[model samples]
Target: MSRNQRWDFVRNKNLCYCCLEEHTVRSCRSKRDALLHSYQATEEAGNATTGSRRPPAVLFHGGESSKALFRYIKVQLYGRNCYINTFALVDEGAACTLIEKDLADELGLDGPEKELCLRWTGEISQTEPASKLVNLQISAANQGATRYDLKGVRTVAHLDLPIQSLGEKLIKSRSDLKSIPMPTYRNAKARLIIGLDNIKTRENAIVGVPLEGRELEGDDFVAVRCRLGWSAYGRQCSGEASRPRILHVCECNNGDRLHDLDEAMRNHFALESLGVTVANKPLRSKEDERAACIMEAKTTFDPEAKRWQTGLLWRYDKMILPNSYPMALGRLRCLEAKMAKDPALSQFLMESMKSYQEKGYTRQLVREEIVSNSNSWYLPIFTVTNPNKKKTRMVWDAAAEVNGLSLNHALLKGPDILVSLMGVLIRFR
Candidate 1:
């Protein structure tokens, strides 16, 4: 429609600006249908390329329905020209350059020289190893396909979509920029993300909108930002603000001196454990406390050997159970306690013993068999009803000793016993 006719429709007859329809813009069905089709096409194309998609000879351009725009550039790897699809973003806070494995394989990049440990990406707190680094020349955008040499680029398996930091410096330098379009992807694009390692330290806390607190859940602490870009709410560590007012300082001794003495003592213990011949000297002066500390314990995993080793002293004989509370029945006292607790349990026990006899878990002992064996270990078998199922379950208490030795101590306990048999409770703040 002409400008004069459009103005006449807006002044005389109320109509939508988008489609010049009689209804308001809020009720525009055509726009909604177009958006729906765009999203559906993206999903269908992604699903179709699951197994048998051909390699792209040129860069893919981001369409109108895309969340972020993309650019395709020619990358020179190993004296050959290769096309790489990439997302050019405004900001990619504190990230390094990364390349995907598939592109690296196609480009004939070598195996990884060393591991790359990445940190601080949503829910990914662990370090991930990267493949071998390679040097490449990538065609610069808006510079008429001018090639620039980029070195030490690392490759990873899932580095398909990379957000290249673009208007970050512009936003920082210019206060006028309210929001910038950050590059993202719904499907595979660029193999490499440039300028990731160029990240700088950000402010401790960003200025946010007013927010309300919610009921806390989950074990690990997480900082959650609201939809309004306001103050985050999640589990946070108790700081000085949460601490009590009362405080005390004792001038007992120098902490550095105490630490030195402790380290010297540990080194001595380690040397003794190794059976090294050394002179035992009493610490006479402050100079004696200044000795070097023992090296910290190290654990190493051998990928080839498929085993883990720790530089810790082996203590095969001694056991370190968390809690060591005493039991009610001990050393042949179990049978008498069982009889006193419940006599019906005795009848159930006898029935279970008969069943055990049939199953060969337990057998009837003849007089000759008893006489032939000088040392006998008599273990009590008991039964208890499960509350949930209301069914009787048998338990062999080998720890009920005949001659003061516990078979339970000698053998490894179960997944249940590990929890149930604990004598101490530890609570972390």
Candidate 2:
């Protein structure tokens, strides 16, 4: 049958489109069962592939020729009175430095096992239990005088860094690039990744400089100066050369599985009873009592305005507010600059402020009143746009702080006046 005819038949029969059952689509069990089965199959397949409970080493191939260049430096890792010289890749994207497990083992490094959730390209994440935080000292192979301590460096079974041969011929052609000591090996293996956590290592690792004369503009290779020596990075002219590919790996240390299990256990053993039950009332603090008393004393109802005006519940009776005018003025200037660029935004904000004045929510302060009020605070206003609603709202920033204190900090939060959900449900019933 045609799509429209099938849909019409299901609607007339008041049957589920998913299962062709008596119930509607909302009550269809077939779709839910199919989704559950698919999830289970995926989980089982993942488990079958990762028998060792470790994520399999993922390799990404970049076209035929790997012309791109990566920053690699030779560093000597010292741990447990053993030192091993290895090439390390400078990856600023990685949060923590990672060393190969074999390299860590060779250096006699051992630490507490850590569970990590590693996410690769395409948002594919897997929980692997084959990582540990190890402490080691690293120094440049050329400059061994300054040894930097690297603490909490994670050890992984494999870095999954692609093997790319450096462009030696290109390096030899340029006089300036050839002067620096660059890696000339056919296949260089980077066993360690120097991340931002190793600040000293990163600072001394790679420093780029433009080549002289014609080599600066048209040259494919760029030479970088490192503490260990010089390194060249750029695309090679040879089509046969493998194209360099970057390994995008993100490490998450938060134990999501344990948290999930905890949540599941809590749900399984949750209290079955519903609605309000007899229980001791939670005691209010001295500050809460003071806030309540302050509100009770200062609150006044205006019959003409049909609104209640209440004084702020100040933390201290004689609390001195900091001068926030400068900050507010700076914020206002920034808003004006933004509004100048966006005419629609400017119109929306002007309309909102005009509405506020018309509704008596705010008023234009006279020059005399502005000068007279020494302790007055100016709230910085900003616009929040809702694209779905096609609306823009002006928000007064009460939490914009100056000297570690804001309008919210000075004023005590009044008593909770929110009605209980259970009480409302019981009343409805």
Candidate 3:
């Protein structure tokens, strides 16, 4: 073809390089469709004759890179088409796919329906539950899109996958030497990240090196380790003391390895958030020993047991925060007198006391005595019916605002409160 004619052909027509056809790449899915149709027909025939047909497993690979292989894909949101890059991270540990909120916003996804507090693996602090979930259509290049449900988090940032110094230099040189053609790589960032929840299908495969050279069996999942750390520029935050550490996650198959790793992580005993390495040296005095606070917790609610659980609390000073307004000053009304006046509330209080005593949360009173008090915190009690059951349980109104003041902080504010109150039924799982 003439130069001008070739240019016109390239610009005007979609060319398939694989088959040297006049269709865009991946446009011809006849082979795939035919295979799928044949499989479906066989499945149907088997179901009719043999009562059921076992479906084949769908597999995916993580490619040579630890990150799951990425592809240029088109996503449909609100009936509009948006082409973006996507990849899967085999968070075989987590149950749901999570997308970056900004990427979702660009794709015209609505705000999260509700907020949830959660934690990522190796995180010392539980993240503020700011992620929302939505469903969208995602497809491989030139293929029909499929519905994919994902949880969207505002905190999911661009992962700077580490590369060799030589690789980095080559990429920079290539960018400088020529005009990069792909729009996606101009400012490359993965827009979508699929997780194990959506990956439970037979259609997707996990590309990975199998342990023991055997195909993955039940609960066989992939894990990868990467270096993670950060530093600040100013003198206040500078120094090699802020060195990064290896963050590794193995979700499945390697039970012994996971157990040992978990034990090691717990024993590392370092103040991770501040980068302070914990030492075996003993503190010289009680005054020198600082209290450790629990900041994050993961819990599972059981409707059958009527409880919430799964966290441990170590020894720490159990004290309420100093009261700003003293009750001994006679600024607040007496709750003892109020409880006596209302029989229903009084009974609820008695039941709560009994429950607390039974669960080892509180000790039974030895004798009734008139004790003078400052800031006499009177936590009111109420009956809460379990939605899944007809049974009613006594619940203290700790969140209630009393005289425009709250004593929620005065109570054990973290996982300890839950751990203390719920007995064996709520022990850490």
Comparing candidate 1 with candidate 3, which one achieves the higher lDDT? Answer: 1
Best by lDDT: 2
lDDT by residue for model 3 (110-193), tens: 555554433444453233345555665454332453443333323343333222111233233332212322112222334444
* 1 against 2, candidate with superior TM-score: 2
lDDT of each: 0.44, 0.73, 0.42
By TM-score, the best candidate is 2
Worst 10 residues of 2 by lDDT: 205-214
Worst 10 residues of 3 by lDDT: 227-236
Instruction: Report the candidate with higher TM-score, 2 versus 3.
Output: 2
Using Cα atoms with residue i matched to residue i, what is each candidate's TM-score against the true structure? 0.25, 0.43, 0.25
Estimate the TM-score for candidate 1. 0.25
| lDDT score, candidate 2, position 258 | 72
In angstroms, the error of model 3 at 427 is 25
**What value of lDDT does candidate 3 attain over all alpha carbons?**
0.42
